[model samples]
Target: MDNSQRKLGTPKLGKWELFAYGQLVVPMAVIGLPLAIYIPPFYSGTLGLDLGAVGVILMLARLSDVFVDPFIGRWSDRTHTRWGRRRPWVIVGVIIMMISAIMLFVPQGQVTNLYLLVWICAIYLGYTLIEIPYGAWGAEISDDYHERNRITGSRQIFLLIGLLIAITVPIVASQAGSGATAASAASRQAMAALGWLTAGLLPICLVILLRSVREPVKGHSVPISFAAGVRVAMRNGPLRMILATVILGALASSINAGVAVLFFEHVAQMGSSSSVLIFALFAAGVVGSPFWVSIGGRIGKHKGIGVAGFASLAAFALVPFIIYWVKPNYPGAVFPAMLVITLIQGFSIGAAPILGQSILADVVDLDTIRSGEQRTAFLFAFLAMVRKFFEAAGVGIALPVLSWIGFDPQSHANSAGANFALTAMYCLVPLALWIVSTTIIWNYPITHERQARLRAALDRRTARRARVRAAD
Candidate 1:
């Protein structure tokens, strides 16, 4: 909006803005779609990493995030440039991610034990560089709570589309082959192709976001030091609650991703088609993104999140009993329950990222009013750190558990240990994490009324400053 036309409660986003925001979601694939869901099993089965080693490698990568994400967010916050603070970092990050994805698939011969570890580090570093800046940008672009939801929701829809395409392509390639053995080989080749396709699209998305979105004008000065910005954000109760919920919620979702494939393939023994079904389940979450976002705005962010979390908890809780009860008595029932549970999990997790993130924007504005600083990017870095930590922790736990279960993936569905491991991973771990997240969110303090007051108060201050400059 033009300077004179802007007012409190003004719609901060237009069609173009929403489009650009949606476009931003494309890059989420660079960081999210692969590692959290697809890569662990891919590395273990395809690239020849053992389950235990794969788990350790993932843990190390997540630990690295603790060190890098905050610094990256701080850098994006402190940067002053014509391209805007978050955009420049995003550009750098995208380039890094593209390189990492390429490196991820580079064919490796039978190798030393360290092969997976080395590649995982490269992948983690690349993703952290890209995602931290990309996530931070979401908060910098809009101050409206609902607008934040719209932008994030639109971004999520395209993100899910990217995920669906990435996932389904491999399945289709596998199916096109002449036989079962050939199908697995064909699927691998298709996966490589899909990686390259995504690599190609990454730059296109970067250009679209760079050319399309304009960062909103800042009304007041804020210090840029990392320590100062973090201090400001931590002091806010509402932001802290949101950050805590995100951390716990992300942990649950990450654990589910790490384990779901194992669950379907081993415990359920549903065959090659199960991969496609699982992908569909993951895609289900993405499809429901807009619905979740709208729900958050219509009710409230906390209430919406609480509802989603409850659904996820219930669905995951039932998975174990369902698997045990129906797998022997009624094999057909297993697949449907698996699909339903995963869909519920996806819907809840997908909504959390979009809606929980919108609250971060509100927190930044509230901080701006209370402390007179605009350090949205830096504040969000803490949230990113928490998210990264939990994803790693999930992998850390899953790897060893998978090992203990004797997940001789080459053996397929006959391994009892593998079957038990899958059930534990998908059903139990997620339920525990969901419970914690729900509790944390129940007491979250940023109501619509409180946020509106913060916005109105900030607007009046800006108006007064404008009048002073005019009189002078």
Candidate 2:
């Protein structure tokens, strides 16, 4: 078919197709929560690895993505297959992730730091394989300004649901057996259950997604060298702006996730309620996804993200104060106050994943217009790599800092200074990062009108190329 005919024939993705695509995030989120929140504690406290070592090892594992993500992105973009560009990579990722999940989550014997490093690195590699291409696939599904919001919004909703399931699984598993189970043993049980759940759900979700959704027809696949792609990405102003925000924002989130349980258990003195609180947080995100999407439509995507970041900042700013002031004076009111703050922050959670990704899809259009090649996956990979780098940095920094401050996760009691340090790291640092991220993207230049123009230019360019080929 000709360019015009293909453009005319592009189908609006049905709800079922969107749901099928979104379903894949469930298993991924299942693994993600444990990696971010539970893994360090599990490996460090239960499995006898040092806290600082776990932090550094996980950081190194994620750093491995520095090379892997870009290579996979470029390879997937250049790959030609009957199954399509993105799907095949996703299939391979599923197999790798499944194997790694079993080994990492369900450890067999007395595993060492090296074992943790190897399996965690493998899992992250698998995650990169799926995430970079999976994100690019979603971007290719639609080019509409508002429709992109819908696409990402759907995925974000599922993502939150998956996180909620991840949180609930441990809570339920911990409670299912004798209530007297030691914390470490309970954690082990939870991880084992999660591993099996991930192993079972991944293939099923993959089959459904592969069967239900058709990959979008490629407009063109001009193979750009990795160096050339990097050069092009460097020159993209919007992409640079987005990456800056991604680094700051992801680092903030990583720190928060790294020390959240420590803060709740040691600083806040509410260990039992941590799981429920996290569940509430993500449940709020599930509810807030569409609200942020609507806000994105009414305002602009970047401004919407700025607004959400501000909201989160306000919520985080209250955390340390609440722990220090409210807990001592009216100890009974602390959890309720924290619950309120967490829900508020959670409501704003949808802004980044839903809108940030939608914004990146728009940025991809800008790059395509400039480079005359569809490098969507490569650009997404670039952003993903930046995000992972900072995320790893956050964990790498937070844990060692905690260890240095004399905060011990294995013990119930910590020094006042250590508790203060946890509070500051968990609350103040993220607050500062969010402020910077919000400032960077508040007036992002690519408005809806600009993206429409970019799309038009791409269409004209495609049509011109088609005519030349016809003439030949």
Candidate 1 lDDT over residue span 352-423, tens digit each: 667777777788778887667666666677777887788788888876877876777556645666677677
Give one digit per residue, the lDDT tens place, for model 2 in 1-472. Answer: 2221223225456788789888899999999999998998889887889999999998999897776787788888888898889989999999999999999999978799999999999999899989999999888888898988988999999999999889888777766754633233237778888899999999999998888777677885456666777888899999889988999989998998888877877788776777668889999999999999999989999999989988878887888778878999999989899899999989999998899999999999999877778988988888788889999999999999989989888887788888888988888998898898899999799999999899898888888888988999
Q: Give per-residue lDDT, candidate 2, residue 126.
A: 90
Which regions of candidate 1 fall more than 4 Å away from where they truly are?
1-12, 108-115, 176-187, 346-349, 413-418, 461-472
C-alpha displacement of 92 in model 1, angstroms? 1.1
Candidate 2's TM-score reads 0.96
TM-scores across all candidates? 0.89, 0.96
lDDT (C-alpha) at residue 21 in model 2: 82
* True-structure RMSD, every candidate: 3.1, 2.3
